[model samples]
Target: MPSPRPSLTLTLLQARETAMRFFRPQLNLHDLTEQQWRVIRILRQQGELENHQLARLACILKPSMSGVLARLQRDGLVGRRRMLEDQRRVLVSLTEQGEQCFASMSLEMEKNYQRIQQQMGEEKLATLLELLRELRGVKP
Candidate 1:
């Protein structure tokens, strides 16, 4: 017998792709992968963070985060340094150029967000966001 309901995991992934379609062009233009942008966005908002903290907030695995940070550092978008007080801890921060890139890209990103809001209606979008947050809090 066929299940009547769609797979929730697959549906969520599809929904993410649909949303990403709006912003992927800006990312491509900036030569940033999704992980790189997520790291930059978090660092821009949170200031310097320990490497593990950054990976957690960015939802990127530790192994993959090393490559993402390397690419960003190579492009002069990010910097990494060992904490002076805690020699074993590494901190990551965005460079000046990274901030400038974020500022420029944010305009386009905001416009795309506004377009999505307009298409969906502000109230519904807000409700959807709240619902998504609640859903994320669910556990098996």
Candidate 2:
């Protein structure tokens, strides 16, 4: 028989799925995939980044990032620019439309977070965030 202890990895995934349940519908309304949203969110928060850096920050593989970036550029949501000083470096950032998309969706996202806070209790939510960071070996 399996051990009484549940899998931590599976529990983390289930928790993520439960949370995405709230965000997914809002993402769908904008015709954005999870990957695209991740890309947009990172760019919006962190400003311009190279493909490799963006790939790392977004947890997207290099090949997948190419395709995702292509689709985003095609959709007018993101743009890649060559650095003025170093032509070899390419940086990616959200376009105006992408900013607008985030602006529009952020209200709903914040409201969902508020609901989650209400359900989990503000202190518990804060503790969970802190614990998750600690679990990742990150200091506050």
lDDT values for all models:
0.94, 0.95
RMSD vs true structure, all candidates: 1.2, 2.5
Candidate 1 residue lDDT tens string, 1-140: 97689888899899889889999999999988999999999999999999999999999999999999999999999999998898999999999999998999999999999989999999999999999999989998
Off by over 4 Å in 1: 1-4
lDDT of 2 by residue, 1-140 (tens): 96688888899999999999989999999999999999999999999899999999888999999999999999999999999999998999999999999999999999999989999999999999999988988555
lDDT comparing candidate 1 with the true structure: 0.94
> Against the true structure, whose TM-score is highest?
1
TM-score of 1: 0.94
TM-score of 2: 0.91
